[model samples]
Each structure stands twice: as structure tokens, then as C-alpha cells.
Target: MRALALYGAATTLGSLVLTALTAAPAGGAAAPAASAFPSFQGAPEAHGTELAAGRALAAGVKFGKCPASEELPAPIQCGTVKVPLDYAAPHGRQIELTVSRLKASGKDPKTKKPVARQGALLYNPGGPGASSMYFPLVSGMPEWKKIASAYDLVGYSPRGVARSAPLSCMDPKDFTAAPTQSPIHPSDSYKKERIARAKTYAQGCARKAGAALRHYHSLNNVRDLDVLRAALGERKLNFMGASYGTYFGAVYATLFPSHVRRMVFDSAVNPDPGQIWYRNNLDQSAAFESRWEDFRTWVAKHHKTYGLGDTAEAVQHSYAKVRAELSHKPAGGKVGPGQLQGAYLQAGYYDDVWAMRATALSQYLKGNPKPLIEQAAPRPEAAKDEENGNAVYTAVECNDAPWPTDFETWDRDNSRLAERAPFETWDNAWMNLPCAYWSAPRQQPVDVRAARGALPPTLILAAERDAATPYKGAQELQKRLPGAALVTEKDAGTHGIGGGANACVNRHMEAYLLTGKTPVRRAACAPHQEPNPVSLDRHALPKRIPAAV
Candidate 1:
């Protein structure tokens, strides 16, 4: 996915009983040594010392009332949890993680009286880089009332993301100076340019982030999460994570099976360590291509309104024309062919944004570029945060397992895939190119297998046509966690399935969260109503497009 295109849903979600849940270039630096934390086996007791140490660290947690924010829908408490910079050297250095919580309402809606509160329901929005601080506020929404009244909604910006000692790897200008990854069908020169740019991006991170990059992997973030759980005083954790967050939850479960009270993994990530960052992205290319067809078909179905085309192929031809035109002259002097692809990629993630993105495309095609330009405009204040997120994303992903050190391997594999998977093949690759020169040392991926009976029942949500985290990953994850059951949206394209408009999905999740019941076999949910085309007028488009991983 393109850097800008990788944004997520705009809606907030809450924790529930069965409830569901849920990079840059530069120079060559040798891959470092193994992580201080050894590879985890199925034994949760193996990490007892670390878990205890994490609890001890929690004793020092300090919380203060959160200052009110217009952006936040509900009041939340904000605090910091300090953890060792390197768990192996507990006393050497420490970093603070920003944590937030919306206390359970405790008042039963029917009784309008206090009820005993359940433990915290911690959340991660799967960015490896998305700020989770806003998650608690989601509990205030009416849809989340059941969960909001039952458990504290907890959110924390994982280490190196948002306000948690952010690890920014590039200057704001350099970060957005070009597409974070290269476009497909590149000429040989363009290919060389991309490789060089990847190197430059990696070197920039090494220079900017310094040694802290070493400690930014998911293993560490998972450890930090345990600390947060300890600090929150929860004997076991209940979690909801989407996209990459699903992977995080899986790893957490693998490491601390006994500590998993409840978990809902939406749009689950593949746990195959061998694939690492590369193969999975290749999978995304095909998945997104199929989703693009879905978008095209939607556009074609509304040919009378859009006037783009009467057929999916013709609609694609029109889109290609827009891309070509923008390549020559960027709309409003900003959004180019690449940026256009990035913007429209959102269409593949969710049907909610299909109309908005299509409207922008139609407007651009009709010689009014304002919508497209505005869509691509940068937020300078957010640039640093984006950089930090990207940095941490790379830190965790690249360091999670072995990535090819040779650029040729990247070029050869991507070059071959680009021919067949034209939409995002190259874009996905360049997004992960920094791994070729990542400065952090690599570690063995956690042996995620449980002994079939080791883990608590986990509810897994999968959208059959999800572009980012493909459905197959969910299937694999379900197999890996014997107690876990999978809920699939029949033909939904959205990345995050739960808490959306699907009543079927919501009911199944509620059943699991409230009663700890998962399907004895795979269960499928009907897709939500397909979005109807809105007025083509720019003002009629959605104001808050759903974000995706």
C-alpha cells in the first residue's frame, strides 16, 4: 500500500464480552544481534520473571486527569507508564508510554444504577504506528453502550508511536517529498532511483532515530503492553485489535496464554514467520486488485450517476486515464499519479470511502481538481507523527523476522509480481524497502503455536475481501489457535469488520464476548448494504472517511 493510502477507519470502537476487535528508506547498516528477549515458547510461565518485573514497573505509573479535547468524544484519564528502554538492562534507561482510559460507566442502562465493572479492555488500532489514545472515547458512542458500561476502555500509544517517545526517522519535508514507495511499471532508471531512495530513507532513519530504533520492535511493544496490563491491575488482558494489532494480540497470546482473558482479532495478520514483510504484501497486491475490481463494478453500476463507464473494464480505463493525466500535471500542483493511486487505494479498504474517492476522481476527470488536491494535502503538524508511525512500523515489521538484505531479491521478486499484480505490487514493496537496510538487529519470530488447549477462546473477524490483511491469514490464525473461532463477512471489502454496519458480525462477537461462545465451525456474515452513490458534488462527500491499515 502507498504510505498515504495506508490510513485507517475514522470510527471509534469499544471493548466487549465476546466483542470483537479489531516506513522509509536509507543507508546500509548491518543487521544487529538477536533481541535481549529470547524467543517465546508456549510456556507462559517462562516469562514469569519479566511479567513480574513489568508489574513492578507499573507501581511507578502516574496518572493525571486528561485535559479536555474537542477531538475526543468523551472524557478520559491520561497517564504515563515508565518501562525499561531495554528489558535486559532494566535499570539502564527508561521510557514512558502514554496511556488513556475511559472508566466503565458502571451504570446499567436499564437500571440506570451502578453495576460492578469488569477489567479493562485494552485496544490497539493495528498501525504498529496508529495512535490508540482515541480508542477510549469510542466507548461513549451509543453502539458501544453494552461494552462501555461493562469494562474500562483502555488505549495506549505503543512505544515509538504518537506521544510515546515517538521514533521519527525522516524530516517532515523528506518524508512527504515523494511517494513512500515507488509506483509499478517503472523504467529501469526509475527502479534504480527507487532503490537509491530506499537507501536514503533507511539512512535517514539511522541518523535521526539513533540507537532507540533497536528497541522499537513488536516484541518490545508486546512487553510494554504486558506492563500496561499490570499497571492497570488486570490479572488477565481483554483485547480488541484490527489488522496488525491482530498480529500483536496473537503474539501476546502465544507468550502469555494464561493472561488472555478475552481477545477479538479483526482482519487478522498472518503469523507465518517465513513470509515476514515481503510475501504478505505480495498477497495484498492480489487482494487489492480484486477489491479494485469491486470498486470498479460499483462505479459501473452507478454509470448513470458517475458517467465514468458502464462496464468495470471501461471504468478502469477511465481511472487509468486520470492517472496518466495526473502524471503529466499534478492536480492543484500537488497530487500526482502516485498520490492519486494512494488516495483511491482507500476505496479498496472500505465501501464507505468508495463514493468519496470516486467523486474526487470524477471531479478531477471533469477538470476540477480541488477535491483531489485537498484529499492529498499534507498536515505539517501531523508529518512528524506520521514519520514516527512509519518508523515504528518499519522497526517492528523489519525486525520481527529476517528480511532480504539484498536489494536484488526485492527487485527480482517485485519486478516479477508487478507484471501480474499491477495495482500495489511495487508500492507495497517500496513501503517495506527500508528493511533491506534496517539498522536494528533481527530476532527469531515467536513460535506462535499453542498446544491446542493453551489459550483462551479468541474471536477472529475476517472480511472475505479485505485488501490489507487478507482472509487467508484469518484462516491460518484460526487453525493456529485451536480454541479460536473465525467470523467472516461473506463478501465485505472493509478491513475492520466488527462495530461496522454488519449486525451479523456484531451479534456473533457479542455472543463470544458476553458468553465466551464461538462458532463450533466457521460462521459467515452477510455483507452490509453496499453504499449508494451520493451526489457528485464535492460538498456531498463524506467528511470523515473510515481509516484502514
Candidate 2:
């Protein structure tokens, strides 16, 4: 499954709202001392009593200059924390986690005095593999100003991610080395090819990552969160997680209920151990199919601008024509039926890009392939990062729970779903197919329901029509967390809905985070209006569309 993509956007209120866009232990063998690295001047000092068993681990953190990033406009402190690779063997091998922080304070314009601070708010952008280190970039946005002044916004690249003892399954070039294969194809040969590809990828991971693959599951990640909490000197953790991060937060609260002060789950994962991961992906297929229909309807309504079709059926026909053409001769010698599906997959996540995508399709049908090629072609520079994300995503999910070892079961299940939920069924199945051949031993799913009454009043946010995490998961999660409230973006289908997409939802989140007041048991906020074709801005298209959540 893909995690949430954290993007920043300025709202009408002049505040920066985070918009959906899309652990472990100490112990084992001795590692290098923190003092060996040069210390950063004026960085916040570690506080709070350290864990009795791993006091040395918590006390050894040292901060330094962060890697320069074009994504981050302001400088933030960065550091590494050593964590036990296997919590059961605390004295065993250790791995380093890259941590970053945007402090909670700024000068008051007139008085030029510093604002008071109120603990820290840690964030995870849900990729199981996504890097959260750049999350603090939202600090200067108006919507984030209040939260920024009150709490230090902290982020970290979890185990197996970039600069955090990164994991790799194959060389960067190998990621795209395979010829494009369309998931929509129904032939037996296609299935055989996909299975072979999945097995090859798994073998590569085993060859390269070795034993590290077994340690990147959710359990170790939750343990790492505790270690980070202690390192930050906070007795109780304050966190906001989206997509898979919701699952991460729920597991943390279950494992360390006493250490949670305030937590938020946006676009929550269904916590039913029985539904975890496999069933959940199946759910996404149907939901995404529905959202795709919504997109076709929207494009149909704007036929004058797109000239593709004036009915959803007609639009779909136009799309099929483009797919057939691509399958015959890939646009720009890169985009094929598979790439075409990949580019349009963004429509299932966020409707904001509907016009841009529709425009690209319309242009392609009119004999211009530039727009479609630009949207579908992969960039060489991003190959490494993309590979890293996929590796971690596969490793964590595969290690976190048992997947059917037989290919026959997967084929049967997905083939049934493909009949009705054709849009994402096969593609999603292929994305997770590597799990069947995963080398690591699987662990049992964490029982989040075990934490029902033991947690703080956490807030949960979701869009009713969210295809990625699906709204039902949010409702399921609410039942699993006793005091948590569910705030729904009524009639909306976007994934990751908390930062500033809707003012009503934002108000509820702010109230809960700032004052510990959970909204009424359930709340609903009117959805954002659909995009207008007449006023659509072509240049506003995101350079890269985020993958599934």
C-alpha cells in the first residue's frame, strides 16, 4: 500500500494547511558513540528521564546541520539516533534513524519577543517508506503558524528509508529495466510474466538487504517511536499520522498508552487484524473504481473544454482508445498502456488534478503526445528514491503479516475483483505481489482493539469517499480507539484530509490538538467544491503524482 503524500498549500485564511496528496529498541552490541560526530551549536538538548534499560541510547543523540533540500525553504536541525535493529536482541546490531525538528518559537512582529513552546508534535507521512524529514517545511505557512509556535514540528525517516540506514532491493536502473506490462491485460501470459517479475524482485531484495528485511516491520517501528520520544525528552508523545501512519499511531498507543498525550489519525487504516493489509487493498480497488467513475463524470461535464466526450461512457471510450493506441506504440517511446494507467491513477487520489489530467488526455487524442508523455514518463533522478520507497513499502507490509505463499490464491482473489473493480484490482495486486515471495518471517498483526479504553482522546479525520484509505476504515478505527472522534469530509473522495482542505475539519483538529478536546463522537464537514473547468489552471499540475495510499 502507498502512504500519504504530504503537500503544503496556502488557504484562504492565509494559513499553511498540510494537505493529503497524497522504532525500535536499543541494546545488543555497542555502536559508535554519539560524541564521535560533531555536535550542532544551539540545538535543543535532550530532556526527560531516559528509559532505564536504554538510558545510554537516549542520551547519545547529537544534532548537526541537515542536508540542504530544495523542498525545505527554511533551515531545520537534523540528527541521528541509534536504535536496536532487533528489539529482542537489544545488545545486537543497531541502525541509525535520521531526525529533524522545526522548533516552536518565532519573534512576535511588533514585540520581537519569542513565543512560548508547548512540547513537540511528531509526524509520519505514511509510506511505511515515505520520508518525513522534510515535513517541517510547513512551519512557515500561516495555517501552521499557531501549531508551529506552540509545538516543535518533528519528523524522521523511519527504518529502511533514506538517510536512515536506507534499504535497497535492486539497483536504480533495474527498477525500470523491465518492459512495461499493463495490469489490465487478462491473458495467462501476462499473469505468468507478473509472477516472474515479482519473484525476481523478491530474490533481489533477499540478495541485497539480507537480514535487515526482517527488522523493518511495524512492531520495530513502534519501538523506535518510543526511543525517539525519550530522546526528545518528552514523557508523553504528541503525534499526527496520515494513511498508514494512522496504523502506526494506533499501534503505538496500544503498546505505550501511558506515553501518549495527543495523537491524530487522518485517513485511518482499518484496524481489524483480519482485514489487515490484503483485504484492505481489495477494499481500495473497489473504492478507487468508484472514484474513477466520479472523475469520468467530472470530465464528461466539462466536454466543451476537453472535447473527449460529453457522457461518462463516451469519456471512458476515449480513454480506452488512448490506452489501445499506447499499447500499440508508446508515446515518446516510454509511455505504454501501463504508464498511461499510472499517470491517470492520480485522479483516484485527488480531484484537484482532474482538469490537468483530462487536458493531457484530450491533447493526446488530438495527436499531441507531449502532455501525456510529460505526465507518464519516469525521471532518472528519482529512480533511487522511488526504489527505496518501494523496497520499504514491500518489506514492512510483507514482514508485518503473513501473505498467502501460493500464487494461485492471489490470482483467484484478484481475478474476481478485477471483474467489477477493474480500475485498480490488478495493478494493486501486482504492486503487492512481491509479498508472496518475501524472504522474511512474518509477525502477527497488532490488535489495536486492545487499546480501546487505554488511550487519550485522539482525533480521526477522513473523507467519506476517500479511495486510498477508504472511509470505512476510519469508522472501524474509531470503534477500535474508545475515545477517538471521527470527523468526516462529507461527500468528498480525496485521501489525507486534515491540514487545511476544509475549514470545519481544521477547526476540530486545532481544538483537539491545542486543548485536548475531542469533537463530539462524530462530526461531518461539508466537502470542498468540485474543480471548475472554466477556471482550471494548467500550470498548477503537480510535477509528480503520488502513488497509492
Candidate 3:
């Protein structure tokens, strides 16, 4: 599993991941006094014998040297780090985080022995629930040769993610049985059903996860990350976080500014303290609508090849007709409006899938449904695995802040939004519905402001048309973190903008990692290429499209 650019969207990983809540309140709840969570009291870095004990405990865990495998581009070691389940009680019960590393590719040629490596570079791909243990495999690819050779590329499955103590909201059967939150209509019946299902999912997580659910928020994860820094013997942390990972990095930078070395937050989440999980999703809906128009325009330009239409409006009409037909009769008995949307949403994320998806839609319009059916095909065990991703996503987001408890509030807001941004409005609302009934007590969102010169210079990257984490977030992050530099991928819709296809952005990233200098002024990088129409092979739709990089 390459870095896959984990983010807020569960399906951002394509069919490999599950659906995450689309929207929820950004309001914070009162923090409980005398909790196990870290308080960021006193100086920036922690001291005393308690941290020493946590580090000593972490050091005792075992890791084996890695061997080459099909799943990875290079050999790497896999290990586990143990941290207290509740950071307030460091001596209490503990959980493990699975970590992986591709030791720096440094060798002394004369002696043909491994050379001493620079400090570790920890990376998070951002699902809050996404498995990051294998990210080093992707991050260490040829594109990152310079950085990979200089530092130990480290990754981990955060607590309650894959290979760790994972969270699950429901049994596999019940999980699969749950309907998607796609808006079938603006009817009260649909709203009621959606709320009822959200309740069922929330209650299931409480019944299954019990006390462990309360510890799955972001603050504890940040605490565990600090302990890892100590265990790895690094006085400072060097981190690269994308999407939701940016939020993690932001909190870490705020609480332990003195302990940060060099950090990069690409497609940063807004750390406005007032814009936590909910407002962010609404922003995403608007962004997606804008990007979707771009996709529609691209398809129209290739109408002679796709046979959809000669204009964007015509293309939309043709697509609507197919969607209406799907609503009446699902393709292969599975590709309903929800499944059709799941297949098409990738177009909003990246231009790479536009041609293929358009071809599928064209074929469906021409009285063939096989392409649509294949697009919605189920992955083996995606049901069970998706539950795990969704469960953890909900726990982290719902516990991070207080959500609006009234059903009327949710219904009114989503109803108003759906009129303009119908694509993902309701779908996102239901995705986040579990928060309304979340059992865990909430803590206030961290106000991420660092004193001037408190931390080293940092770099933030954003794509102008990114739908998930929009470009405004990058600007906000730059404004909040004094001396921070911002990089924009002009007109690009891709969520994760650096180190995949953009050499210019990569150069900036490498410079910041190898040397501590960040640009003094904002910068922009051009998109590599606009999507082109695929060959007009109507019968050959791809089995699957990889998630946007």
C-alpha cells in the first residue's frame, strides 16, 4: 500500500478504504479536568522520570529487519511501540502502534558497510484511520531518493488502525447491511432513516469498543507520537503529514514547538479552532462542485471521442439520465445512485480517472450497463475492513470536538447545502452523523498558534482546486504559523500535491528536509498535465482506478 495520500475522505483511498463521515460540527466541548490526556503544561518538551519510563517501555518492544516483498519497493523493518492507553496514567494499561522503517540508503563505498544515518523522518498519510506502516515504502521511492538516503523513513499505523488495536463499530454483516448516506431525495423519510442508521452505528461502536473508544482522539495520538520520538532517541521530530495528517502535525507543532525540527503539511487542514471537522466538510462540498464542473468541461471537449455531448450542460444532462435510470433499476443489482456516485467521485479528486469514468457513463447511456457494474464491483473483505476504517475515523473526529446534538440542526444545514452542492452534501452529512450520538466526551480543539521563532521554519503545500482540503487552508496555516512558507499547485484538483508528479514541489520539499531553509515568499507550481480522452474502446472499462496521488 503506497502512501495513497490518506485524507478525511474514507474512499479517498479508492475502493480499498471505507466511507468516512462527510460533515460534523466544529465546536469544541469542555475539557475534563485531571484526565489521562497530555495538558501541554510547563515547557514545550516533557521531562522527568515518567517520560523516561515510557521511552524505556517503548525501547523494549521487538522489530525484525525487513526483507524484500511484493508489497514493498524495498526492504524495511517492522516493529511496535507501546504507549499507555491513557496518557494521564503512563503506568496504566497500554496499546501498541505498528511501525515500519526503511533505514536510510547510506553506505560507505570503501568499506561496503552501512553508513551512519541521519535522524528518523516520520510520515503520516492522513486517514486518522489510514494504515501508515507501509508509507515509507512509497515515500522512499525513486522520487524521494535524496531524502530517503539522508534519513530513516519511518511510518506507523496509529492506534486503532491496521495492524494495531483496530476499532470496529459493527459486525461484518451489519456493517455491510448499512445503506450509504447518499441523498435519495429531500424527503423526511430519508432523513429519518439516515439518522436511525447513524444511531445504530454509534451505539454499535460503544457496545464493541467500550472504554477503548474514549482514548482514540487526536491528543492521545500526539502524546503517543512524542513518546515515539523519545524512544527513537531523537531530541526533535521531523514529520511529513498530508490532509488529516496536517491536523496531527499542527497539534504536535503547537504542543511541542521546541521539539520540532523540519515539518511539511501538504493540503493542510484548517486549524482555525472554530473550523474543526464539520465546517471543513461543507467547504469540501463547495470545492468539489467547482472541480466537478472542470471535469464536465473536460469531457465535453472530447465529446467526439466519448459520445457524451458537445457541451458541459449536455454532458450533465446525459449523466443525469443515466443516474435516473440507476435510481429506477440498479446495475448488476448493486450500482444504485450511491454506488454510481462512489464510482464518479474520483473525478472530483483527480483528473486521472475522468476519461475512463466518462467512457463508462457513455456506455451506460448507450444501453450497456456492464461498465457501470464493473466500476461498482466489490473488493474482497472491503466490508469488514471498511468498518475498521470508518469506526476509527468516527472515534477520532467525534472525540476531537463537540458536534451539534440536534437532528433539526443537521437536517436544516444539509437541506440548505444540498440545493447548491447536491453531489456530496447529504452523503457527507450522514457520513458524519455518528458524531451527533458519539458516546465519548469531547475536548476543545487545539488553538494552533506558535510564538514567533518558537519552531523551525516549515513548508505548506496546497492545490488550488483541491476538493477535500482546499487551498484556503494553506493560506490560513501560513498566516497562523509565522515565518511558514506556502506552495500552491495552480489549478490542480489533486489533494496531495507534492512528491508524486510535481518535480518543482518535490525540490522545495527536499530542500526543506535536507536544509532547514523555507522560502521567504509564497510560491506556485504548475500542474503536470490536463487529463486527455482515452481510446474509444467502449467495451474496455478499467477494473479499478488507483486513488489520486
**Considering every candidate listed, which one attains the maximal lDDT?**
2
lDDT of every model, 2 decimals: 0.72, 0.75, 0.71
> What stretches of model 2 exceed 4 Å from their correct place?
3-53, 56-60, 69-74, 106-115, 450-453, 534-548
By lDDT, is 2 or 3 better?
2
Residue-level lDDT of model 2, residues 1-549, one tens digit each, is 643221000132111101100022222223222222112232211111112113423364576677775255455888777777776555457778888988877554346677666677998878778877876877765556667777888889989998888888888876754226575746898889888989998998888988777888887788788777666656568998888888988988876676688998988888788777888888988898999999999999999999989998999999999988887888988888777777788788888778878988999989999988887777677778888888888889888888888989998998998998898788888888889998889989988864456777889998999898888899988888888898999999877767655778878887887789977699989997787776457566332112236
Which regions in candidate 3 have their CA more than 4 angstroms from the true location?
1-39, 42-61, 65-74, 107-116, 177-181, 535-549
Worst 10 residues of 1 by lDDT: 17-26
Candidate numbers sorted by TM-score from highest down: 1, 2, 3
By summed lDDT, which 10 consecutive residues of candidate 3 come out lowest? 16-25
Candidate 1's C-alpha runs over 4 A off are 1-60, 67-74, 110-114, 178-182, 535-548
Sorting all predicted structures by lDDT, with the top scorer first, yields 2, 1, 3
TM-scores for every predicted model? 0.88, 0.88, 0.86
lDDT of 3 by residue, 52-150 (tens): 323433353355764343145447777777777776555467777777877777853345566556678888777667766666765435567667777
